[model samples]
Target: MPTTVLVAGFRGSMGQKATAMIKRDPELELAAVYSPHLETTDPAAYDLPATTQVFNQLSAMDTPAQVWVDFSTPAGAFENAQFALEHGMTPIIGTSGLSDDQVAQLTKLAKEQHQAGLLVPNFGLSAVLLMQFAKQAAQYFPDAEIIEMHHADKKDSPSGTAVNTAKMIAAGRKQAPETVENPVETIPGARGANYEDVPIHAVRLPGYVAHEQVLFGGPGEALTIRQDSFDRESFMHGLNIAIKQVNRLKGFAVGLENVL
Candidate 1:
């Protein structure tokens, strides 16, 4: 039998893409869809399968879905994941606004419920590889900066990928690398956001889909690792990998790299 899936935020771009992928996959079943902000509960309204159940309220979501695939907003992600776990469904979260504390809370909840779930920062293989390569380089370089670019529609700044990359690099570093302090500040916030001592710059533009660069500077030269997602198709492969490996997760884990 195919694994049943409940796609939260079914009206969103990533959610729609996930729904299509699930339908195309023989091993996965689109049992239900949830979009709290949408009033229409008819699957046909969203161009979803007629047999698929539609839900607008969390309290009313009692379906046979074994997996909860979420691409909802940061505001709704935590509640959705908790609901999935409380109802004995694994959550595959693709949303990127969750803080470290929120992730920790969800991880604890997943363990208490004995459920395996994932919170992925980026579902693009190139992005995942970039993070890995950056972590590896951090050991030798130790000093680095991150720049993430996304579409103007993206709600979160700095992105989950950039923050994750910083944390990953921090974990791999042998020692804390000292940064050159600017004695005179021409601009107060010119250095960008800091995560684990690494600076992250965020850029939002109309033409961009998703792109990121990890720059490592040493005494002699600097290294740059870059990844680009020109289209949504770039993420599907890693998302598929995450879906197939969901049950193998240890509680609520972050990154598609965990499954990779």
Candidate 2:
């Protein structure tokens, strides 16, 4: 039987691509599409089948969608995933604005409800492998930094992949020695954002799709691990993997590698 799916943020670039991928897959059914920003709830307007349900308001959503594939904004993702969990739909979250606390709360709720889902940082297999490789590298080189580049229109700074990479590095590395910030620089924030002692630099440019590099330095030597997603299609393979394996999970979890 085909898996019924609902796509949030259907009007956005990534969301539109996900919708098309679903349509092309015979095993997946496009049961619905949603976007709070959309003016019309007409499925036809969204280039969906006439039978596909459309929802502009989360409060009004009533569909047969068994899987909630969210490519919504960071602002809307938390609530969207929460709704999916509450409604007994397995959520495959791709949007990345959720805080650690929010993820914890969702994790708790999922276990209580006995629902299964995932909060994926980056769906590109290369990105997932980069994060995994960075974690392994962190064991040997404790001093590390990350630089992430995305398109100019990307709203989130320090893309989820960068943040996840930092977290992975933090998890694998030994205790980092405390150090004071350099006061010599005239610029106040030139050092970039700090997460668990790992510095992350985010670059926004017109030509970049999504790219990240984790650099580690020690004993006058350095190692760099990088991944690039030149096109949105790069993420489809991992998302497809998540969608297929989510039903086997016990509760809400984080990371695409977990599903892989």
Candidate 3:
């Protein structure tokens, strides 16, 4: 039997793309869809098959689902994921902004239940490669900064990709080095926020979709890696890959690199 998948935010762009991809894939099946705002009578009004079950609450889902895909907001992700895991379902989290403490808790739950869970900060392949390159470059440069730009409507200031990239670079380094303490009066707050000594700058603009640049500076040379997502479709392929691989994973996994 094919793996049954339930999408939490089935009406959103990411969720819709994932649903379409899951329907096309041979290994996965769209078992159900859930959205808080969806009407109980016509939950499948948004292009889904009329036979598909529409649920407004997680408790309303009676049938067993193998996997639960979350493309919802940060505020809703943890609750949605918890509901799935408690019900013996695997969770594939595509939403960002989950804290370290929350991740640890979720990891513990996944381990206790012997179920798999995945939290992907960024689901773009190019973004994952860019982070990998940054990790390698951190050792040589030791002094680097990241700039992330996204749509103005994005709630989080520092994108999850930026935070994860900084953490990865920090972990790869030998030791924490002292940052240059030169105080410049040219402009206040010019340097941006520091994530474990790695400066991070966030930009929110109307036209931007999602973009990031990591710059590493050494004695005389500098290297920069950048990735851009022009549309939501850029995330579809990676998300599909994650959905297929989530069941095979034993515990919690962060980032797309683990599956890749």
Among all candidates shown, the one with the greatest TM-score = 1
Task: Write down the TM-score of every candidate.
Answer: 0.97, 0.97, 0.93
Residues 47-154, candidate 3: write the lDDT tens digits: 776656778876677756788889888999999988888898889898888999999999999999888899998999999999998888787777889999999888
Best candidate, lDDT = 1
Q: In order, what lDDT does every prediction score?
A: 0.90, 0.89, 0.86
Ranked candidates, highest TM-score first: 1, 2, 3
What is the RMSD of candidate 3?
Answer: 1.8
Cα RMSD (Å) per model?
Answer: 1.1, 1.3, 1.8
Please count the clashing residue pairs in each candidate, in the order shown.
0, 0, 0
Candidate 2 local distance difference test against the native = 0.89
Query: Which regions of candidate 1 are displaced past 4 Å?
Result: none
How far out, in Å, is residue 121 in model 2?
Answer: 0.7
* Higher-lDDT candidate of 2 and 3: 2
- Give the better candidate number (1 or 3) by TM-score: 1
lDDT for residue 151 in candidate 3, whole number 0-100 = 93
